[model samples]
Structures are given as structure tokens and as C-alpha cells.
Target chain A: MKSILTEQQLEITIKRLAHQVLENHVDLTNTVLIGLQPRGVFLSDQLVDEIKKETSTEKIQYGKLDITFYRDDIRKELHIANRTDIPFSIEGKNVVLIDDVLYTGRTIRAALDALLDFGRPEKVELCVLIDRRFSRQLPIHPDYTGKSIDAIVSQKVKVFWKNRDGKDEVCLVND
Target chain B: MSLSTRHLLGIKDLTVDDISLILETAEQFKEVLQRPVKKVPSLRDVTIVNLFYENSTRTRFSFELAEKRLSADTINFAVSGSSAAKGETLLDTVRNILSMKVDMVVMRHSASGAPHFLAQHIPAAIINAGDGVNEHPTQGLLDAFSMRKKLGKLEGLKVAIIGDIMHSRVAMSNIYLLNKMGAKVTVCGPPTLIPKYIRESFGVEVNYNLKETLEWCDVANVLRIQLERQNQVLFSSLREYNIAYGVKRKLLDNLNKEIVVMHPGPINRGVELDSDVADSKQSIILQQVENGVAVRMAVLYLLSGRNPGNN
Candidate 1:
């Protein structure tokens, strides 16, 4: 059978991560999970679904962050960024930021700067599905990680979801 | 042999072979127009849509006449009084119109890649009438087509695009197409209006003085002064701009007399070019407008996948 993560393994991993979050974080009232654009939104939703299934309630809220304009490289040119529509309010919430793959942590830095425009959060904790911690430029670390892989910068690791391609698997492509 | 695919989004998308094929086909269409009846049976049953977001009466009329002369039905959709003002996105409007089963779409928009974006999604063949400052492939083709006729061959011809380099889509398109056609191109304008890295990127010379550029060129293609461009802080004043960059009678006399002058209309009569020069023996401005219809007709028929007369 050709599989990256078996259906049984993915279900077990979600439950484990939910229990880990519950053990560390006590306040669930004002807690929110915000996802980075594209794949991060999908991972955040999966985490939220697992938390709801375990607790039997929708106590947490979700939002999306688009950091296209906030990046340092876009300073020289015109700053007309792509769509950044956050439907839910994030004022004074305990936020858990989620992403699919974390490489240089520059995207997170850009997202953090963009988030300050909306409102300051009580706290911001980073969560990533696959953390290839080889190229770390900033003093940033993921609090909760699904898996960590040792790899060089010349390769790219892709996390496949069933919603995207009917499966959950990670593959490294030559960059 | 027929040209392979449809959709003319950029000159970058055209292969060298495809460029030659279009020029050759346009030559045939030009011949057909010179007859007693200035009409062809090339695209009889096809319907062409002139969907222009920008206000260009000259370009719009040219495309309309091009389709009509080719025996194709044409619908002119000007942006001012259209459903676009009712808060509909361009793609949504195009898709709704495409459902009517139009054969080809000739689009002119202020946004650079808007026509290319439409080409990717829409089922109908696309002809980029004009995009922002990015490209105007048909204008490039017609300019090159007209230049080739005068010079006999594009190889070793020195062509300079004078005035408004920054805001001129005509200049950008000509630089790429003329270079591809093997003519050495030079862009001359003020440093503020000219992009910083144009010379390094296109391998073309950039000069601030028109006299220096014209001395080395066989053809000088002058661009119009867009007053709205001044509002965008591209330049400061019109009077200063015309005195510095405008090509007048005195300037024309300074150039090589064999140097042909051309402008894409509607020209600013006294701003970028002198009215006498535009109306002179050296000017191919009127010839360019006349050739525009035939060139566009060839493009429509070629992209439509219909035989020139078999349709």
C-alpha cells in the first residue's frame, strides 16, 4: 500500500496533540487558533476539529493571517498586498498560531507584525505540523510540533492533506 | 501551415516563428484590403467582442473596423455605461459575456496582466488590444510590420523610441518586438520617467538627449504625453515636459532626413509631436493607422482557427 501517513496513524496523532495542548494550557474561554494563509488555515482547522471532538464544545475561535505586504522585501515596491480578510475578532485573546511547515520562521515574523494592526493578543504560541529546524535565523521556536525532520536547505518538504489531495503524506522535493 | 494556439497575452509568449507567420498573414490581408472592396471573407460567421476598460476611441474603432472588414460581427463594450460600474469584477463580467459563445475577445485594460489573466480562464480566444504599461503585443506587431515594410529588413536597423519611457506601453512593446525582429533599439527620455534598469535588462541603449539618439537611428517612434501621467508624479509640468522632450519641426530637421517619424494615436497634437511633422512626408503615422485594421484582422482570423476563406 502506497501511503505517507496511514488513516489509523493520522487519527492517533491528532488525539495526542489535543491532549498535549490541554495539559499545558488551562484557560479555554478566550483562546483562539489563527492560521497562516494557504496550508496553515487547513492545519489550524484540523487542530480545532480535534479539540472540539475531545471536549464536546466549540469554545475556541479561528482566524486567518495573510502576510504578503508585511514582509521586509516588499518595502521598496508598491505595497498592494493580496486579500487579508479576518472574519473573526482577535482582541485580547490567547492565540495559538498554526502553520503547515516551518523553515526560516520569517513568515511567522511577518505574520506577527501584521497581527499587531488588528489588536494585541494576550499571548502567541507557535504550532507547526512539520518543523525542519535546520535554518533558524530568528530567536523563534515552535511550542507544539507534530514531527521534526533533519534536512538541508536544498530540499523542500510538502505535507499532503486529504482535503488537498485525498491523503496525508510529506515528501521532500529538490528545491 | 496554420499558427498553433490562440491567446496573444504578450510578445514574450510569441515564438520567433509565430511572429513571422503573423507578419506574413497580415501582408496577405493588407493586399486583400487594397482591392475595390476593402473586405475579406476570412471570418464570416465569427463574433468578436471589443471589451475595453480603458478609454481609447482610436484603438477601439480600429478593432471594430478590423472585425467588420474581415466579415465578422463585432460588439463594442465600452466601460463607461456598461454593467462594470454596477460593482462586478472583470472576470465575472467576462465569464457572463463568454457564456454567449463569442468567438474571440479583444481586451484593453489599465491593469497590466488583466488580459493574460482572462486568457488563462476564458474558453474564447483572447487578443490583447492593450494592457497597462506592461505590454501591447498587437501594437508592437503592427509597428514592427510597418517598419519592416519601409526598411526592407529589420536586421541592422537602428530604432529609437523617444519620449515618455516610463508610462508608454507603446515604447515597452516596441523595444521587445523590435529587438526580437533584429533591430537595435534605444529608449530616450528623462531619467525620472525612464526605469532605472531598462538598459541592463533589455540590452538596449538608454539616452537622455533625443539629438544623440536620433543621430544613430534610421527610425524614431515618438510616444504621446499623457497628462494624467503627470498627476501620478511621473513628471512635474506639461510645459517643461514639452520643451524638454517634445519632437517639434526644429528637432525633426536635426534628425537624419531618411529617419521616418511615427506615432500611435490619438496623438497630443502639439505636445509630444509637432502637427506639421505628424502631417509631413516623413510621417508614417497615418499609414500605421491604416495598417492597424488589416493587422488586427489577420490576428483575429489566425487565432479563431478558421480558414482565411473556408469559414
Candidate 2:
């Protein structure tokens, strides 16, 4: 029902996440970034840009990944497919799986299955802009977290990117 | 919409949303097909039997590829002039096969409603590959999926299905599915090949003249003449049928509008379509073949409650 993150806060959180990624993994050769499909694509693109600017690294290796078919809730209803454009090989590379809002951790779990079809990675990690508190159905946790939201079960966490929705902000909606 | 149908007996049994869901799922699976390692470990424990009563090289091969891609252990049950012709009933044969603990049956029988009949008696999933003159649901699904991919949408698109309607499970299924998708489907062919009371029953228009049908439609689905199924009652000769219904490049170009040409293949190239037209830019015949693999995968995947081991 209210805006938890304004434009300035979203921009600041993105810069902080970029610094954290660089501080953790300095040598970015084998490190590959994959954005979960749909909204995560926008956030991942911004984060990739921030990392590149902060570290002076060209071609940080990022792509979109869709896990629609691998989802456990596939039979519950239909999910529209998003474009996946991972041109580089992820085999033996450090894979960074990124998403906007991490609610149940199920989407990331499905992404893990989808990533294996490409090839086996040396290591796989998760990154999310909004970590919805106390809402994970799986034991999966993000390696890099941007802004954690203390939201209840009935409310939803939504992230809007300036490139996409003409503003950068996060809001909690009553379902 | 979620898929809940126990059997894919026909397009007549599928709702429009069901058709949409299948196409959407096929879209994702199509991407999977393009991957280097195309096989997935989704249907690992599931045993699917490709029980083909009739011989169709493309359909059988496509279904086999789909089954393998999903990691389902598939057994090809091809009945020749042996047991099926030696007076063994279809029900008995299917039951005997099911006794082997098969999880699903993809059957292509010569008799209409054979799969439907099997679905009634069997506990396994029944996928009607093609049941004589009744339906080839997967073929129909892929055709619509291809059309929507090429044309951007299906609703209100004028689709003319030319040649051999009465004998084609493809034509019947296409009519049922396309009409449900809000596409205006006109059955065009020699009057003898078209079943009577289709207009009265299915409420679809019938066109006898090929040129008129070509000019009035956005896409023309040219069906191969089922020469094996025809007799003296239908038409005089193949040459006469070719002259009347065969789609040539000249006829398509003269329409002055881009009309997509589609054929459920094993194409009698010079009979239903000219060899040039079959390989023409406007023809999506190859796309139909490629899409058939994905559509069948979507069907098998959804039928088993999303078979690829859900994470």
C-alpha cells in the first residue's frame, strides 16, 4: 500500500550491490551473470552496468534465463515464456543468477535446473534486489542481497525500473 | 489454463484456452530443442509406448524425438501385417501392451476413435497420434502454432484447407481447433472428397473452386490426397484431382496477396502442391514439421502433471 523504496534509494542500493560483487569476486574472467527472465532482466542490466563502471571491466558476460518449464508450479497454470539469450558458455564458470524480488526462492530453484541444461558450472550464486523477509519456501539463499523488505504473506513486493517503468522504485501491494 | 484432459483424443474435446496453453508451452519447449544438449531429465521414470497401428514416418519420428528429448523411455509398438492383421483386436493388443507397465500410450490407429476407446479402458495417458478420420491432435496443434508464429495471431484469420477433407484426420482436427481459435476455416476441394453435412454440423464454409478459395483466404492448408484411402466413388484419377485442387506457384502469385501455404507432409509434391510451391518462401511446411516435435513434447510434458521433474 506504500512505497518502501523511492528513486534515490533504488539507485543507491544498485551502486552498493555492484561494489559488493566486485569486492567478493575481483578477477571476473570465469564469472558469468544471468538475469532471471522478465523483470530481473532490467535490474540485472543496471547492476551489470554498475559493476562494469566501478571495476573498469568490459564485457562482464550477462544473459537472460527463463525457467518457465522447470518450475514446480507449471501444472498449476500457464506461464508466459521470456527470451533467454546466453551466448557465452557457462561450463566451469562462476555463475551469478540474478532476480528482482526473491519471495519463495522457487523461481531461483527452477533456474538452477534450467542452467544445468547448458552445462555444469564450477559455482552458482544468487542475487536479488528485493529479498522478501520470512517468505522462502526453499532453503535457497541469495549470495548478494540489495534491499531486504519486511513484508507479510498477504502483501506483494514489486520492483519498477526507470528504464522499464520510467522510474526506479519498490512498493508493497496488499493482495 | 492448466491441462487436465486425460486423453488427447481430438481437438473437439479441447477448449480454446487448452489449445492456447499447449501452444505457449510448445513455445518454451521449442527453445529447448534449439539447445546443444536437447535431451532433458524431466520424464525419466515415465515409460511411454509409441503404439502406432498405421505407418507415418514423420509423425512417428517426431513423437519419438519428443519422447527422447523429455528423457522418457519409449518403446515403438509398430503393428504390421502380423498380429493386427491376423485378427487380434485393437483393445486386446493395447491391454497386452499396458500390461507391460507403460505409463502412457501414443497411438496412431487406422480406426476412428480407437484411441478414444482405449482411453476409456486404460489407466495410462492416451495421446492420439492419429485415429482414422477422427483427429490427429498434435498435428493440428503444431499447424496452429506454426500459423500463429508466422502470422502473429490466429483470431479471424481466413484459413482455407484444400484437398481431401473427408478422409483426413488432419483436416477434421484443423477445422475443430482453428474454429475454436476464432479462425474462419473453409474446406475446399473436390465435392466428392469433402464430407457432406460439415457445413450444417461444424458450421464451416465449403469451397469447391481452388482459385476462389486461394483469393479469399490468408492461408491455404493443402492436404495430401489419401490415395490409399480413396476408391472409385471419390474421383476418377489423380491427374483430375491435381488439375482441380493442386496448388501451383502461378495460382498463389496471381492472388496479389501473400497467402501462406501449409501441408501436413509426406507431400505428394506435384499432386497437392507444385514442387516449387512446396519449397517456396511462402510455404511454412518445414516449420510445421519442426513445430510438431515441440507440440508433442508440450502434450507429453503437461499430461504427466508437468513431467520434467519439477524443482
Of the candidates shown, which would achieve the greatest TM-score relative to the real structure? Answer: 2
Off by over 4 Å in 2: A1-11, A22-32, A38-61, A71-83, A87-94, A100-110, A119-123, A130-141, A147-175, B81-86, B305-311
Model 1: residues >4 Å from true position, as ranges?
A1-175, B306-311
Among residues 3 or more apart in sequence or in different chains, the pairs in candidate 2 whose N, CA or C atoms overlap within 3 Å are B42-B308
TM-score of each candidate? 0.62, 0.85
lDDT of 2 at B174: 93
Model 2 chain A worst lDDT window (10 residues):
A73-82
- What's the true lDDT of residue B57 in model 2? 95
Best by DockQ: 2
Candidate 1: tens digits of C-alpha lDDT, residues A52-149: 77664657666776664345543232222233445555678777888988888888887787676667778888888778877878778999887777
10 residues in a row with least lDDT, candidate 1 chain A:
A74-83
